[model samples]
Target: EAEAVLGRVEDVAGLFAETPERSADSPGSDWEDRLRDLAVRAVLGEPEQAAMLARASARELQATLGVDALRVMSGSISYVRRFWAHNLKGAPKASLEAWFEALTEYAVALSYSRRLCTRSVACAVQRERPGSEGRRLAADLAQRGDEESVDYGATCTDAYVAGDRVRSLVNMAGLPNWALHEGDEGAVEAPGPLHGCASICFNKGTVVLPLTDICRPRDFEERMCGRGKPCRGFAPGQLVRSLVSAACHPRALARGLEGRITAVDRTRGRVNVDFGGTNDNGTEGALRVTLLLSDVSPVEEFEAKLQSRREALGGFFVGESVRSLIFLPLQASRPLLFGAEGVVSMLDLQHRRVLVRFGGEEPLQVLLRFQDVCLMDEFEARLQERRGVLAGPLPG
Candidate 1:
């Protein structure tokens, strides 16, 4: 639905706005313009930009995001190319090489690394919000070329179009031998890269498709052709955020909690998440909590938006006073964010934590924005009633 508002930014005054009857498909001529989906997703994940990411790439971002913000895109193509070579090594790669290459690219596109991620700016705002966070613009960006098609689309002809001398070699799914090799240079020659790829047409009209679509050749999973086995996606010991909402599913689990996966029980469709918050005798904080496989997602890019903060606080402004969350039990030798009041200093985007300058000569303590602190209003009652006690009894 965000795409519907593709050209809203220029319509800021809305003086000449169209009525509600306009069709989304023909919204604007700007839809014809495009940007590299690769570069757009790469450098766009930088701190302020990452949090402001709008999946529907809006044009307002174009006006606001300076050329400097997008400079890394040209170089980041190298990273994507590198990941492809390393990932495709030793694969059966017969006909489905195109699809496999797409997967690695999609995975890298969403990589948590700020340098390599693919999220794009949500609005045209300053690089960093000084006083407090605020609303941002969101609009539909161009549908990336071949990116969408590479994953789900793409026919045999999509790759080896015989006699079709194409200039660019970017997204073409040429065969392994035809793949761009090391030390290659200059503007790519057409048929030179096509090579033997064009001859596949005579092999009884063979067609290329995704492994999931194909039924045979040994289903792609669990040491897939001796390739790395996928542990149902979530690997043991990887950090995951609960998809459940505490308010909506109080009895089930809490949202925004980062827990490590201890074990995955595929037979029962369950996974054990270790939150380290156990009762004195052992419970939610102690023993591993079992969750349905669907209740959690990975935090490759960890940062929160205005919605992720406490609505009661009005706004999380810099220098705003704050207090730590109720002490929760933690792994031995791990630091606890549960003591004393502090002032909200700045957002430490690198660590994905809030740098709170606590009182006294002590240094700033970076606490998890979701679980470790709150506004000063009801601090006393929550502490007295023991309502928000997420962790321990507070070690004296």
Candidate 2:
């Protein structure tokens, strides 16, 4: 009975799998046509026949793929969804849409138990790199003391580069350790040089993920600052507005100083602004000054804007006193990460601190102390009142 059921299920699954191709050939082909064909062939007819077909398919799938295969395929589907979803949060809409299509093919292939075949093909593609080619690329980078090539080989287990570096993702993984050249052997070790060189290990396959996509420890540090001090009460949109206003301020305009926003801290109500400086020719050179928001805004405006901005921004809002919680707005700048160039706004309601994050291929967080802020106007006082409401005790 079980064998019979398995046969029935396999028949239905096979038919369903072919439906797409059939429909493409004959536009009029429909699900009913497929079902009717199955029904006519079965000894058991109508509803019973359809039901039997489904049950058999399920049983056969379980038998052929096994529970572990099914589980892995299902998990891969979920992982693909989660990976893209997380990426969509920070990526531009157009880029996200493009990646969505690219990942769909990867996700669909991963859904099959046959994904190992696909992975094998991808791994084989590494053979196209330099050293794996006709001529072996010399390891000149090793002599130059370049750590990047070494780290790349360690991280990816495969790399290939022409010119100065002996980089190739393929041969590096399996090269014999003793075959490596030993320089400075028995010579006096230089100050920073180690006694024994660290050889690259290629036993395990490297899991290559885009560095920009992975959130590193440094990103958390840049967003939170040292000791994980959260940037409180700042939102990205508000910070943008603040920079625009500050750049337009009379004194700033008089000096031809336009503020370029680098980071926003919603939690602490701070903005990191870059003040453009004049060059020898009287044209603007690179920006040199970082003005805290407190130094630019009228005290009252700065305080008032924080609450108003919090309401406008709207992602996550937190505060201690109604006057000082970080109001996270809906729109957020991308977080600091390798190869990521843009601004980020951080808010920490608990400490009522906000940090504006900026710079480096690797992210770095710098805290702006409230004491460091030079208040500008009466607007600060009014902002304090609104913040009071956000942070105040709730009604019973």
Backbone clashes under 3 angstroms, per model: 15, 52
Each model's lDDT comes to: 0.39, 0.32
Cα distance off (Å), candidate 2, residue 236: 12
Off by over 4 Å in 2: 1-13, 17-76, 79-108, 111-274, 277-303, 306-396
Question: In model 1, where do residues sit more than 4 Å from their true spots?
Answer: 1-315, 326-337, 348-352, 385-393
Write the residue-wise lDDT of candidate 2 on 334-363 in tens digits.
333212222324555456444444454544
Question: Against the true structure, what is every candidate's RMSD?
Answer: 27.3, 23.0
Q: Candidate 1, residues 1-396: lDDT per residue as tens digits?
A: 111112232342242145342222233422112223222222233333333332222333244442222223323434555665686687676634754544443333332222212233322333332111322211111122323223221212222223322221111112322222111122211212231122212111222322111111122232122222226687667888765443211132446578777555454465656654445654432323556666667776334422344342334545668788645345234344565688876665554467676655544455556446667895776576554453646543
TM-score of 1: 0.19
Per-residue lDDT, model 2, residue 301, is 55
